[model samples]
Target: MYDNYAKVIVKGSPITKSNFKLFNVNGRAILPMNSGKYHDRYAIYEEEIAFNARSQNPSKVLDEALIAVLKVYYKSEKRHPDTNNITKSIFDGIEKSGLIINDAQIRRLIIEEFYDKENPRFELELFGESSFSMDYSIKPREILEEKITYNPPSNKKKALNDRMNISAIKPKISDNICEVCGKGTCKENLISANKGKTLICRTCFKKLF
Candidate 1:
């Protein structure tokens, strides 16, 4: 088994999953085909990657178990493709490049995407079954920390679930109290804001607005 690394630098944007159109045939949802722009870019990627692989002059393709790890750095921040979608596109390109007999031979796959404003390219690392079993000591360190106020996809879903589950933990807006300002006002006349999560009297809402 072997461990190999190759870099492919291409000029165009990668195709995203959203670029395909869905058709309903016989009540079944089917993805008809990728858009023409996607095919065009993919063709270019295949050619460039194939040339680079040949230049590197690797050994004959292994017919045994294989694994591929891909790191894709995209150039534009304007378009964010699903990370998995970009992997699929590159996988096809790798297969067409004849770097391997078929992509189906790949068992374990990992793909990541990053943003690069000036240059967009993909770096791939291929590992054979034996190479993965060997002892390796490469530990990655985080160079940057990005702090976001909102949660990520998984945490966002969890947050939403928590919010939905706390239906009984509502603010008690008494008939004579404003929940926001704690002003004495008739509850029947208080304005319900933020989908009932927050209760504010008309005066407070008007003042804040």
Candidate 2:
């Protein structure tokens, strides 16, 4: 029942995101960077996948939760990349291509691995969840605009009273009011002035100093 779907095929040896080398810095072991080979391969793979995804000509990026089915083909069966790592690279490429807002939008993912002697590639299929009805008329940009332009109702009086109550409950050095501006001051912000005889807020203290 998933009518909304898009397919992308990236031709090349699929790369995984988990390949990294460990190094010791200042007597502490750290594995902070990916291997040079992985970095270079991933860069090219991501670019190719983005191009393929854009070529699909999807009406708009799917905003709702999605289901991804990934088929990873390797040149040899002796070495196989981690399924999760492959999925990560694909999701990142899809996001970079603007096929979706973010990879977190994918709620379900399915992956399969195979060996191809001549042709090694990644085949990806994305679909809206069967339970939800996807509206092709609403673009992801429009959805973002709706969210950004939305303004929630605010009660200024209630907010002011809440702040006043919070300030009242806090410990104070003096009267909890700034001497110079007569604004509310907390204990942490109050500074002693005139040989501990008067207290002033940090702003007034800075001005005097």
In the range 1-209, model 1's lDDT, one tens digit per residue, is 23343344444455654354344756753333345554445455556656665555455454556667777788776556667777766665666666677778778877767887777777776677755643435676568567536345775898888887775565544545667778866576688877976777788888887
Worst 10 residues of 2 by lDDT: 144-153
Tens digit of per-residue lDDT, candidate 2, span 76-157: 7766676677887788778888888899988877677887979999888888885544342434553444332322236676
Candidate 2 local Cα displacement, residue 6, angstroms:
0.6
Q: How many clashing pairs per prediction, in order? A: 1, 0
RMSD of 2: 16.7
What is the Cα-based TM-score of model 2? Answer: 0.51
Tell me the lDDT of model 2 at 73: 91
Q: TM-score: which candidate is best?
A: 2
